[model samples]
Target: MEFFAVLIAWGAVQFWGSGAIVQSDDWFVALRRSLRKINGAVPRLLLTLSPLLLVALVLFLLGPILFGLPAFIISVVILLYSLGRGDFHIQLRLYLNSWQRGDLEGARRHGEYFDPELRTGAENALQLHQAVRKGVFYHGFERWFAVVFWFFLAGPVFALAYRLLFLIARHEDSEQRERDMAFQGLYYFEYLPARLLGFAFALIGHFDRCFPVWRQLSVAELPSDDYLDQLGATCLPGVSAEEAQDDSAFLQRASDELQAAQQMLSRSLLCWVGVMALIELF
Candidate 1:
């Protein structure tokens, strides 16, 4: 447990490091390629990789004190490994650049670089494009932030394992029905944690609105595809998860008429600030 302090420090460092280095190609390109290989591997291969990773993690964990390496060094090793996850942030950078470039469609296309399925689900080119950007906040907090935050709280191995588990969980194969089963399992894991992430944002941004909104949103029945979460994000000032998830038909009855999207934008930030304050408080 002596290394626990290292774990916490490493978590903070890696989180900040990610924000700093997300634009670099060195980590993202390598990670995407490596993950693609791992993705193509059989499940049994992952089982094999898991134990090996475990061994390596344990060695570094215990080696720091016993073998003369410093704890900070050990922590740096773990964070460096995480920073190898370059592909995860490439689309994000692209999305941001697109916005900077006034290329809304480019931004949208870049955002959904993850799954072809999600990319296809949007009603039209525009909806598909926009959904990707709207989805970024979720990915930013959930997949990147919370996953790392929780993992580093544990250890390098724990963090890597958690992410690997989710990556494996997200894989859909030949069986169409099985995909739903896997998705269900995925959400099950995310249920409480995702809410916790919201709480974290609440802690950071709005100390005033943090806990109460977190509690309220926790019980709120989110929409299909977690649309309720989006609506709740609309609970933030000026932010509109509703517009983010709007229909492509241009004429069809929009499914997310809960409120003005501009308001949703503002409210989402309020919620974010609130979650951040919550994190700071507790």
Candidate 2:
């Protein structure tokens, strides 16, 4: 039932993309604002999680209804809502189109939509695109892989909890202490799933290249984004500084790398779904 719920939710997202009907955080923002008026950390945290608690309570009540169909429907809805909040493919396409046209400035502007820090950190078009590549990989993991991992392991409740924590950690207006605590929670939650996704990358991508990096970073306390970036870099063909010295060559190479990253993400996701299906079968 959980597996079917996942399949349905995944299919819906792919078919419809992340339209406002399927994804929105405005309610969460409003809830957080109300919760912030509370007096203490414990109360605020509990209030922040109150939605998940309510969800769990409702699922519990619905578990015995109509052979759990109601619970299943709610699970799919929550999972859909829990997915990464944007149309990643569209964003990637816009960025790539800009890169392909030799519009470095336009590409950088598109990349900035993904990582505002790219504006300051990237020295050239190649560097900016590479940073965007890493950002893409990280977003793929966070928005899809991590959410699916929690959903499969625990159910929709934990998946929703993970998303809630992510929002708190990344929210600009969140209190410093609240953000810190949320980040800490996410660190622990994402640890295993991130490594597992890296392992999947190794299997479906350049195994000889990716495996060693995966093994080395397996036990490290590095954040998920950094860890996945390192693994993703290894999975792709290397680009030398000399190859990127010229404008045309650098843009082409960066475009190739971004395409490679997209393919790797797609393959890894298919691999994960296959593994999940096999697990359910046997």
Candidate 3:
């Protein structure tokens, strides 16, 4: 049932591109606002997690109904809702269009949408481009791989929890302390999945070059973004520091690298699905 839920949800996301109807966060924003009126950290935290609790309660109540058919349907809905909020491929296309046209400023502006922090840093076009590349890889991991990982490991509950924590951590109006705590929770949730995704990158990419980096970082406390950046750079076919140093063709090379990164991400996801199918079979 879990396998079928994942398969159906993956197909639905591909067909609908972002699944906006199920991915809406207006309710979350409202819930957060109401929770803010409560005193005490514990109470606020419990209120914040009430949605997840409600989901768990519903699944529990539905578990035995019609041989679990209703639960399966609910699982599919949760999985779809837990997916990343935006159309990543479209965003990548816009960034690439600006980049390939030799519009450095325009590309940087597009890149800022990927990582808002890019607005403050990235002294030059090269630096900005590199930051954008890292952003691309990180977004792919968090938006897809991480969600799928939790869903496969536990169920819809963990998947929803991961997405909720991500939203809290990234919420602009969230209190600093609340965001910090959410980030801490995210780190714990992401650690294992990040490593697993890195391993998948090694298998589907340049294994000889990427495997060593993956193994080396397995025990390190490196954040998921930096960890994926290191492994992704090593795995991509034509990516190298020297390519970025070339002034005349750097933009073209960066564009190619970005495309390669996207391909690697796709292949890694396929690899995971194949593995899961095998597991379901056996």
Candidate 4:
């Protein structure tokens, strides 16, 4: 039943695209406002999220009474909502088109949509390519892997909670301590899922090359943005600086790398679905 719900949500994502339904930032705004009224970070987070959590809990409880359909529907809706608030593939396509057209400025501008800190000013095309690829992989982990993980681990309610925590960490602009607290909460929640996804990426991609890197990385390194960034790049087909014989070759290789990365991610996603289906069968 959970697997079916995931399949339904995945189909919806394919047919409608994740961007068709716009999830409002208004809730986050309200939560942030409410948090400001609180004294401590943990209290602030809890108070702001408690109501939604309660509502989600109520919905989950209704599932058994309603013959599991309600739970299934709730899972689908929450999974869709939790799969990031934007269209991941669309932005990647736009970035690729811009890069192929020799529009470095456009690529950088689009890249910022994924990561505001992306260093677009680098004259080295490879550097810019690496930065953008890193951003895409990290965001992919956040948007897709984390949501599906929590959904399977618990239920729709926890999935929704995870997404809320992620939004708080991503969108809230606050003092160092507050930001640190929010991010720490997100980091801890994502720790297991991220490693799992990294392992899957290795299995589905260049495993001999990717798995060793996955093994050698320390616990301290595993949870950071750099881990996924590096893992994704290494796991996918290699794109070397030597490939950049000229500007055109450099741009072409970068485009190829991005496409390869996208394909790798898609395969990893399929691997996840397959694993889930096997679990469901057994």
lDDT (Cα, 0-100) at 220 in candidate 2: 88
Lowest summed-lDDT stretch of 10 residues in model 1?
250-259
TM-score of each: 0.53, 0.95, 0.95, 0.91
lDDT of 3: 0.85
The 10 consecutive residues of candidate 4 with the worst lDDT sum are 216-225
Candidate 3 clash pair list: none
Q: Note each model's CA RMSD in angstroms.
A: 8.0, 1.5, 1.6, 2.2
In model 2, residue pairs whose N, Cα or C atoms come closer than 3 Å (at least 3 residues apart or on different chains), thus clashing, are: none
Task: Report the lDDT tens digits of candidate 4 across residue range 38-123.
Answer: 68767776775685767677776877876877767766776787788678899999999999999988898888767777643756
Q: lDDT per residue, candidate 2, 1-282, as tens digits?
A: 778988898888878876336577888889888886788776787788889889999999999999999999889999998888878889899999988998878888888767778766577666786689779888889888899999998999999999999988888778888888998899999999999889988987778887988899988889988898888888888577887888778778878887888888888888888889998888
Candidate 4: regions farther than 4 A off: 19-22, 119-123, 218-220
Estimate, for each residue in 125-172, the C-alpha lDDT of model 3 and write its tens digit: 688877988999998988888988889889999999999989988887
lDDT of the structure predicted as candidate 4? 0.77
The ten-residue window of minimal lDDT in model 3 covers: 237-246
Cα lDDT tens digits for candidate 1, 17-92: 4423422335433443455534434443344335436546566666758554564455445444443233444555
Clash count of each predicted structure: 38, 0, 0, 0
**Worst-scoring 10-residue span by lDDT in model 2:** 14-23
